[model samples]
Target: MPLPNILRYLHREQRFLAVFVVGAALVAGFVKLAGEMQEGDTQALDIAILKALRLPEDPSQLIGPSWLHSAATDLTALGGVTVLTLVSILAVAFLLLLGRFRQALFTAIATGGGAMLSTFLKGLFARPRPEVVPHLVEVTSMSFPSGHSLNSAIIYLTIAVMISRSFEDRKSRIFTITVAALLVLAIGCTRVILGVHFPSDVLGGWTLGAAWALGVGLLAATLQRKHKIEEPDGSIADQSSGPAPDQIGS
Candidate 1:
């Protein structure tokens, strides 16, 4: 079967395509808008405000590096990309152990596909890192969309979705969501606190990440509903009244 046909079949029963197309278009439009933005003076004003707010500029100033390193390592271990790798491996391991090939296949596709989309989008944006001030921590990459923040959203949120499958308590769900959110927020904030990313860079990254992840998530939900990949739940629904202050970062 052709690729489009397969994607349609993968999500055949729902409005995945409509949402993906529209979400992707919006992301593209925002990327263009960010690129066209020439508000350096505005950013300068914000930077002055940031200093006035007495926010710590360096990660070490906010938290010591040795301690922050351990924290980053801890989070890194639990971070999205890491979880994706671990899950893929374990899923394969489980498939081998239990002969659950279908379980392995679908989980791999949803998780793996999301990771790939995140990578592709990162490369496409390739925004340079901020040079407004000397970086507080070492970094080297295009900085338009923060890879850590974007990937954290995809990875953390994906793992949380899978974990919610077995848990049934309200507290359990809330905890999982909180942990995932804090991880994303922390990773993004680390970028700015480390002085590697401007506040706007992080904002653009969060916007793109949110739209991308939500689009993928909604697609995943629609597919699960149509394909019956897993047990049904009131999935991928949101109750937010407005854009999350995801940039509650820098």
Candidate 2:
């Protein structure tokens, strides 16, 4: 199958460039946003958004239909510890079954590292959860950066990038990334709507999460380039024409 010319070119010539530009941008954004949050610059915006989700007379009561609240709760769960853990385990198991041990290790490191990073940031910030509106869901963690939003982006986006490398078709790669992005966006929104996090919290999470995920991907790509880790099926190997005949490449 013919890949999009630009996408293929990017994979071959600009992998490092792409990761650097995107990762740097995300890190910069996260820093700027965190500073604003610390200075209380985001207070007005956060309050406005939180209020918008609730009824005018009673901030404790959500504005949406009953079903929406339930749906948001379900979606938010997708980013929770239990759900994400199961996903990581299943993915790693599948990779191992295919004998892609190195890829499996990379997946474990990316997901585990992201979780640790989230916990550390939460402790460092120790920002309180929103009080303007009654929380639709119970939460006890620090709230500057929503853990659900951050972890969801890190896990889903990293998995998407890894899986996309196995496909030679540009459309397939784009679709995978797009889907991951949408899921991250939806989960972040749900946290805000549930009144468990502030807008700036979600923003901070996404910014840092994107940076972390892309950074891991860059490392994996570097290892693949050096033949230190196994490349996914159809990935360019030393710019070879294709995998060795009957090699069943990882």
- Each candidate structure's count of clashing pairs: 2, 0
**What 10-residue stretch in candidate 2 is worst by lDDT?**
241-250
lDDT of 1 at 109: 67
lDDT of 1 by residue, 1-250 (tens): 5566566556644455776776787688656646654445336753653343233564234344456644654554453455657755774565445443443455566567766766675577676666555565567667656667766666566556544433458688679767877777877766665566666666665666556555655654544444434433322223264323331110
User: Which candidate number would show the highest TM-score if scored against the true structure?
Assistant: 2
Model 1 segments more than 4 A misplaced: 1-42, 45-84, 87-104, 166-171, 232-250
Candidate 2 per-residue lDDT, tens place, 73-191, comes to 99999999999999888878877787778788888989898999999999999999999999989998999799999999999988887776656688998999899999999999999
- Candidates' C-alpha lDDT: 0.57, 0.85
Model 1: which residue pairs collide? 127-143, 127-144
Candidates in order, TM-scores: namely 0.60, 0.87
Give the TM-score comparing model 1 with the true structure, all chains together.
Answer: 0.60
Candidate 2: which pairs clash?
A: none
